[model samples]
Target: MKKIIFFHLLNDYSGSPKVLLQVIEAVAKKGFEAELYVGGGAEGGFLSSAPCVQKRYFYKRFENKYLTLLSYSLSQLILFIKLLRYRHASAIFYVNTLLPFGAALAGRVLGIQVIYHIHETSIRPRPLKLFLRWMVERCSSENIFVSHFLAKAESFTNIESRVIYNSIPQNMVSSGANHVYPYASGNKFNVLMICSLKAYKGVNEFVRIADLLSGQQDIEFNLVLGASDSEVDDFFSSVTLPDNLTIISRCKDVIPYYQRASVLLSLSKPEEWVETFGLTILEALSFGVPCIVPPVGGPVELVSEDKEGYLIDSNRVEDIAAKLAFLHKNPEVCFRLSEAARVKSLSFSVDNFESDVIEVFNGV
Candidate 1:
C-alpha cells in the first residue's frame, strides 16, 4: 500500500531532522511510496535521497510564529486535497502532534486514516494539551513514539503508544568515517556535549564541572557545544566559567568533536520528565565513546552502570565533577566502558528503524 508522510519542515541541521530523514528513506526503501510536505528549509533542505519520497514546499518561509501556523494549516488543506484523489493509500503518517490535528480533521473530511508519531518528552500550552487529547480520543487509530520515556512524559491521556527507538542506517554506522580526532592537545582532556546550549540541557552543569577542574594542575577542560547559529551569541552569553574552559558555538559537524572527546557528558538537572530519551547518549555510544548522564530521565534508559560508564544520582556539581574525575583517572576503565558502549549503540540502528516502521504499516 502507498503511504504518505507529512512533516512541518526539513531544515534539519539538528538531530530531529536527521531522524526524520532516516524514516523517510526507510519508507521509500521498503517499496511503499512516500511524500513530504515541508516549510522553509535551511539553504535547500537536503534531508534525503529517496526518489519515491516526493516533496512540496508549502510556504516560501516560516517566520512570525502565528503566521507560520497559518501557513501550516493552509498547506495541510492543499495536501489533503491531493491525497483525496488517491483513496487507496491505507495510512497517513504525520510527524508532529499539531500536524496530526490538521491531518485528523482532513482525514474526517476525506474519509482517510492516519497514524501519528510522538517524539518529544513533553510540551507546554495547557489548552493545546487538552485539545490534542480530545482530538486523539476522537480521531487517532495508531500512534508511535521515539522512546517509551516520551510516551510516559506526555500529559495527553491516550491508549498504548508503541515505542520505536530511532535507528541509524547500518551503512551510516559501519561506514561513516570512524571518528577522527579534530583538536591538537597536550595532556588536557576533551569533554563534549552535542546538544543545543539551552538552560534545561544543563550546559551550566558543564560550566560548573569545568570550574571545578579549571585550576587542577594537570588538565585543561575543553567543551565543544553545538548551538544554533540564530542564538550563537545568546548561547555564548550563558558561559561564565574560567579561561581554561573553551566553548565552540554553532559547529556544522559534531562527529569529529564526539570522536576527539574522551567521554560524553550529559548532566541535565532533576532528570525530570523533559530528559525522556537520551538520543545524544546513544549517538555518543555509537561512536564508541562512554557517556556520563544523570540517572533520572532518558539517559538512564540509554546509559547503564556498565564497566565504562555510570549514572550520577545527584544533579549537584560535586557529583558530576567526581564522575568525570573517575573516568579520567582510570583510562583503562574508560576504554572498557567504550567497548561496551559500541555494543549497546547497535540497538539503535536505522535499519531496524525501517524494519519496525514497515511492520507497523503491514500490521505485523
Candidate 2:
C-alpha cells in the first residue's frame, strides 16, 4: 500500500487539526496508509488517539524569526533524515499549514510529491511571506486553499491552486427540534461569541458590545473563550465586564451553548487579521443560529446580507448592538434568517470535504 505522511503544525483540536483528522480518515478509507507527523508532540491531546492514524512522529515547528535558525536547522535535518527512510515506500508528503517549511524542504530533497494545504492568510513580515510564496511555487506539487478568499489573496506568481472550503461534520449539527428564539421562551435573548481569546478574534470588541447593550435587561451576552482559566483571569482583570455578560472558559463541547444562542457573533476585526474562513460561523448556522459577521475576510462569503445573517461594521460596537437589538425585537425576521442559515450550512458538509480531499489525493 502507498503511504501518505501528513505534517501538521499543532497538536490541539483546532480547525486545521480537525480537518487533518478528517482527511486522514478519508485517506484510510481509500486504502492508503496515513501517518501523522505533528510539530508539537506525538501525544497530541485528542488527535493522538484518532482512528486510522497508523503512526505519529514529532518534530519542532519552525519559528518565523532569525533567532531560531539553529534550532530550525537541526529540526529540518532530523525531519529530512526521517523522511529519507520512507523514500522507497511510495510516500507522499502532505503539509497541513504554511509554517511547515522544514517538511516541504525535506519533501523536495527526497524528491517526493508535496501537497500543501493552506489554512491561513494574513501572513506577516514581508520576508516570511516571500519565502512561503517561493516554497509553494517552486517545491509544492499541489496547493489547496481553505477558501476562495485565501486563494485570491495568495501572492504566488503563475501558480494555480485549488479552493476547498472547510466543512462542518454532520454529527456536530443539532437535529430534530427547531431552534427556539430565546425571547420566545421568556428568557433573555442570548448572543454568543465563541473563539480563541486572542486580540484578533475581537474578544475586547465582544466585551465592548456587551457593555453597549448592558442597559437592556432582557438580553444576555455570552463569550466563550477557548483559553485557560489563567488566561481568562488575566484578560478579564484588565477589562470591565458588564453584569449582563458571562465568560465561559474553554469548552470541549459547545453544542449546548450553540443550541441556546439566538445570535452568533463573528466580529473579527480586519486590522488584526482577515479570517481565512470562519468555521465557527458555519457551526452556529448548522444549529439554526443567525450570525453577524464583519464585512472582511472569508466569513463574509458564508453570510448573505439579511438572509443567513447580516454583515456589520465589527469595529463599531453600537452597530453590532443595534443588529442584536433588531433580532431581539423582530422574532419573525430572526426565524426566517435562522432557517436560511441552517439551509446554507448544508452545502459545507464533511462528506463534501472528504470527497474533494480524496479526489485531490488520487490526482496527485
Candidate 3:
C-alpha cells in the first residue's frame, strides 16, 4: 500500500486505541504515508498523543451508554461521508475494532482494500454483532485478529484472516527489563490489576479477593482502571473497599505499578466477558511479574498453566484468594513464575508485531 487511512470509534485510554497507535507508529516508521480518522474529544487520552500525522475528527465521545450508541451511529454516518473524499486515492482503509463499519462500507464502494483488526468478541446486542460480522464477510478484504482465540471465535468464511498478537510498547518493554521486583525488597505483596472500567472485567471480584485477604497486612491490592476520577468514584459509591485495596483511576503511567507489582491478576469473568487478549497481563509478565489469568480466551495463550501463571476461574473468589495467598507464602515459587513470565513475554515483542504488520500489508 502506498498510503493508509485508519479508523476507530473511540480514542480513549483503552487497549484497542493503544494497539492502533503501535500499528500507526510501525507503519509510519516504514516511510508509509498514514492518516487517522477517529472520534473527537481525545484530549489527554491515549490516542491524543499519537505520532505526527494528519488527523480528522468525525464524532465526539459520550459518557452515557445510550448516548454513546447514538453518537457512534452518527459518527459512522459522518465517517462514511468523510471517507468518500479519498475515493481516487490509492490508500488502504484500516479499520480498528467492529464499531467502524461505515469505513468498511465506504471502502467497499470506493474499491479500496479494507483490513479489519478485530480485537474483541463481546459486542452487545446480538443483531449488531451479526450485522458487523456480515459486514466483515461482505466488505473487508482481510481481517487481522489479535489472538488465536479471537481468530477462532470470530471466524469469517470468505475473508482472509491472520492472528497478530498485540505487543507491549517498546518503552514499556525497556522499562520492564530494568524494573526491580518489589517482593525482593521485603515490600508488601502487591497484587496489581489494570483494566477498563467494566463490571464484566471483574472489578468487584478483585475487591472481593482483597476483602478476603484483608487480614493479611503484608498483602496489598491495587486496582488501576481506565476511567475518569468521577466515573471511578461513582462506580464504587455503593460498595465498600477494603483498607488493603487501593483503587487508582485514570492511570496514564503504569510503569511504576509494574515495577512494584508482586503479582498481576486478570480477573475478567469468563462467562460475561472473554477477553480477546489481556494487554495488562502481557505488560505485567514483561516486568517478571507472575499473572493470574482467566481459564479461557487469549490470556490463556499468553500465560501458561502452573508455569508463567495459573489459569483460574475469576468467579471462584475463594480459589483465586487461595492462589494469591499461596504465592505470598511461597516466595520461591512466585520468583520462579516471575522469571518464566518475563521469558514468555519476549516472544511477543513489538519488533515481531511490526514485522507481521509489514508482511500482511506487503502480501495484500
Q: Rate the local accuracy (lDDT) of all candidates.
A: 0.64, 0.78, 0.88
Candidate 1 wrongly placed segments (more than 4 Å) = 41-91, 96-100, 153-160, 175-186, 217-226, 238-241, 270-273, 306-308
Task: Put down candidate 2 lDDT per residue, 1-364, tens digits, no spaces.
Answer: 4578888655664677777777887777778877877655553343565455544444453334564545555555566666777666688899888877778888887788888999887676667777877888777888899888888887466555798888865557434125554433347788998887778789988989899899999889888877778879987897778999999985667777887888999877788678889988988888888999988778877998999999886788888888888888999998999888888888888788889999887776
Q: Lowest-scoring 10 consecutive residues by lDDT in candidate 1?
A: 176-185
* Model 3 residue 196 CA deviation in Å: 0.7
242-291: candidate 1 lDDT, tens digit per residue: 76676776565566666667777876666332665767788778777788
Error of 1 at 215 (Å): 2.0
Error of 1 at 11 (Å): 3.0
Write down the lDDT that model 2 would get: 0.78
Q: Residue 50's C-alpha lDDT in candidate 1?
A: 36
- Candidate ranking under TM-score, highest first, comes to 3, 2, 1
| Candidate 1, position 85, lDDT | 54
Task: Report the C-alpha displacement of residue 223, candidate 1, in angstroms.
Answer: 4.6
Output the better candidate (2/3) by TM-score: 3
Tell me the tens digit of each residue's lDDT in model 3 across 173-232. 999898866663447999999999999999999999999999999999999999989999
RMSD of each: 4.1, 2.9, 1.4
How far off is residue 187 in model 3, in Å?
Answer: 2.1
